[model samples]
Target: MKKLLTLSAIAASFVAPAMAAEEVNVYSYRQPFLVEPMFNEFTKETGIKVNVKFAKKGLAEKLQQEGEYSPADVVLTTDISRLAELTDKDVVQAVDSEVINANVPAQYRDKENEWFALTLRTRNVYSSRDRVGKLGNDFDYIDLANAEYKGKICTRSGKHPYNVSLVSSMIAHHGEAETKEWLEGVKANLARKPQGNDRAQVKAISEGLCDLSLGNSYYLGKMVNDKEQKAWADAVYINFPNQNTTGTHVNVSGMAMAKYSPNKDNALKLMEFLTGDKAQQMYAEVNYEYPVKEGVKRSELVASWGDFKADKISLDEIAEYHGAAIKLLDEVKFDL
Candidate 1:
């Protein structure tokens, strides 16, 4: 009886740590369909289970409130602006993984290693291929303000985060004065009041209410694959604007290690795994995004759209300038 008791105690001790170490908690702004399969695959490959909580907003605040008691080991979110907010709030920590360093480009990863982008989404112009023809060739976003496109261009409200970042990129590239003028000019060219997401703008283009619009490249991918969206995507010719000058404005869906992650090692491992070829490819192929991992092929659909130079501006700068971009939008009466 004594020997059995001692053996039982030893077994419990070993099992407890094993059970604790086998799980990682994640707070994600990305939809479950976008992230779950990868998590399921990770568990299958490594035996480390993932516990995820999905929300569209307030994740950073939730993480901040949880603080040291937070069970989250990792955070995954879209857009550089939100990631920058997390970094500013110190909700995430810098990770030094050699795999991450090698795979993610410097422009896509935080300089201090707080976060790294796994996939890229380029914001570019889309136009009616048949309507513009040669005029669409070698076109750039800066050309949106040209008199010819006035009352012919359609886009989301500048209040939208995506457009804000694009405007911010212009500010970063052209300085405040020039950027303000550019915003006012683009505002002058609106086909109608800015009031929808990227897809809606594409719909407007397809309906002949407009001839061109700005949208993320992945939207085109989603459109082509989705039965309902195929017509709108098919109706437009994709153009990667600003290619010769500053490259296409790109953003990311990225990941970071939580500041008080209890499963630090596992979290880092997961981050590295995401940056690996398999996960990167899965992310891009599934979502119609460009992989940040070097040499990972984009989805055939994305590749079919052809390639363009991506803006080299550090996305962190885009984040930093977000507020000013919003102010510029207001000042130029972009919303009205």
Candidate 2:
């Protein structure tokens, strides 16, 4: 009976860990198709089930309202502005994982360790290959505001989060007064009313409606890979601006640990695991983005575009000045 009791205890101990690995809930802005494969792979490897709630808007407000009662263990979003908004609202907790710290570069992660970038995308300018005759070798955001480019440039609405962040970064570097002036200059240069997403702006360039427009680096990759999009992608030359100065203006799709997470340990494990080699590679290849992990190779599409400098500014700063940037954009009447 003694030996049987001992054996039973050993069996129970082994079973406990399996039972402990329950499910983790995630709130993500990324579409389900974009992330489900990764989630499936994670479950197969770790035996942890994932439940995700996805929406294009208002996930932040939902998390904020739920407060401590929120069942969400992790929050994922694209772009620095939204991630920073979550940090400001205190919806996320500061995490200090050595794996995350080592994998994500300083510029890409929150200064306080509240969030970490999983992948990077550059905000670049695309110009018709034939019209530009080899787009300027080095251009920065400031260059777009140059008087020469006025009435020749095109972009999406300034209210767009991506453009707002770009304007915000300009404020960080040039101060509000100068940034506002730059906004006016960019506005004056608009070929037509700012309309459409980044991809649409590239389409405009391809159609000869505009000479140049602002776009995200990865969108070009997506275009290049698709038969219909290939012509637009092939028609333009992508210019990584600010390489000689602040490097390229880059943004990220990142993740954070929810403050009210019931499964904190598992959440941290998932965070660290996502920042690891396997997950980083998956993110980069699937999205055509630059990996946050140092030394990870960019997608062949990204690599073919050539290397450039990336801004070393902390992304949180860009988020912090977002309101001011928006105000400046409004003052300049950046209709696009």
Give lDDT tens digits, candidate 1, residues 18-101. 777688899999999888978988998988989999998998999889999999999998888888889989999999988899
Q: Candidate 1: where is the Cα deviation over 4 Å?
A: 1-21, 134-137
The models' CA-based lDDT, in order, is 0.88, 0.86
Tens-digit lDDT string for candidate 2 (1-336): 999999999999999987776888999998897778788878888878889999898878898899999999999998888898888789999998888898888878889999989888888988888888456556678878788776778788888888888888888888999988888888888889998899898888888888889988989988988899999888899888887787778889999999999988878888888888888788778888888898877778788889888888888788889999888877777883
| RMSD list, candidates in order | 2.3, 4.1
Residue 19 local lDDT, model 2: 79
TM-score of each: 0.94, 0.92
